[model samples]
Target: MQGAVGELRTLSEGDVAAAWALEAAGYPPEEAASLAKLQYRQREAGELFLGHFVDDQLIGFVCGTRSLEDHLTEESMDVHEPTGTTICIHSVCVDGGLYQKVLQNSSKTNSDRTHSSKWALCETEGCGDPVDGQ
Candidate 1:
């Protein structure tokens, strides 16, 4: 699925490899997640992982999971909870040197979280929406 600004699509089963490449490139070896971990995140909570593409080529991504945990941890890197209230951002990697390794910030309580919450800004003419599996 292509968006108005390049493509703003969520990562799918077939996109694990590409997502892994981005992770490895943006994160240190110790900080980077294993392929299996990445796969689980995509399978379990992929809706939170959005990819950016130029001409259908993936150049960056924003990924995370739902969790009650307040802070980023090695364990959080491998887990996702669907019913979790807090959005634990795992990573945000942009090709233009704007790579945020892990969402190191502690979680905050939110009773009114919605999809409209701006995560990644899709830079294109009138295209700020992100595409999920829907």
Candidate 2:
């Protein structure tokens, strides 16, 4: 891949447009969250919204919310506590420029902020499918 790695950081409300556009490009209508919805999410748990930027452009992201439930539901998307044991990941969207093989080659991802050790990778896995180019 020609692309170089970007900064991995927590996204704030200022990045909403980029986040919304990225979501539109990365996910189908049935799956993509609306700007209002995204804004609400940011209000709920902005700390959980993470993004990858290349040249200051959003390329990918992983979004989630802290919860008490061991399992996930549609309601999980609407509710997010600032502190919780369970983190329900809602989406993982990557840029169209990158390929699956390249992503597979990538490992040991990191974020600038510190999180709790008690928190596990609560992967609310989406339908198993390859990332599609826009």
Candidate 3:
């Protein structure tokens, strides 16, 4: 199903459940972050947690924590370093039916270095994989 037009914004506490839903749906259970882990990231590093909302509902998200480590590590993935310069992206999830639509809409703005640079050093893992069968 095609979602209504959406906008990208920093995720908030209100978005926790919706974000977790997409996370669990888009990844294998072993790869998905726990609901508690998602909550911790939202609380500790909200600035790094970006979500795509369609008609007030979350359809996609890119969530992570800030870290000093050059690459994603067990410590960086579990902890949010307030003063860190690197962004260890943990989840990049999109609804199964809305992958192409959401990406087309978000890419124009999100691909800009200036916008992404705000988060700094985005070390994304599995960002290239398709979340849906598409």
TM-scores, in order shown?
Answer: 0.66, 0.71, 0.73
Per-model CA lDDT versus the true structure: 0.58, 0.61, 0.69
How far in Å is the alpha carbon of 34 misplaced in model 2?
A: 1.0
Error of 2 at 94 (Å): 1.0
Clashing pairs in 3: none
Task: Rank the candidate models, highest lDDT first.
Answer: 3, 2, 1
For 9-103, candidate 3 gives per-residue lDDT tens digits of 87889899999989888888888899999999999988767788877878788777766655566787789987765566677788756666655
Question: For model 2, how does the per-residue alpha-carbon lDDT over 1-134 read when each residue is reduced to its tens digit?
Answer: 24576676777889877888877887778778889878877778777677777788777776766666554545667788676555555666777665343233222232224243223242334322222111
Model 1 Cα lDDT, one tens digit per residue, 1-134: 23334655677888778878887987788777678888888888877776767677677776777655444444555677676544556666666553442222111111122332323222222322322211
- At residue 123, candidate 3 shows an lDDT of 30
Two-way TM-score contest, 1 vs 3, winner: 3
Clashing pairs in 1: none
Which 10 consecutive positions of candidate 1 have the poorest summed lDDT? 102-111
Candidates in order: C-alpha RMSD to true structure: 10.1, 6.4, 6.0
The Cα error of candidate 3 at residue 75, in Å, is 1.0
Q: Using lDDT as the measure, which candidate wins?
A: 3
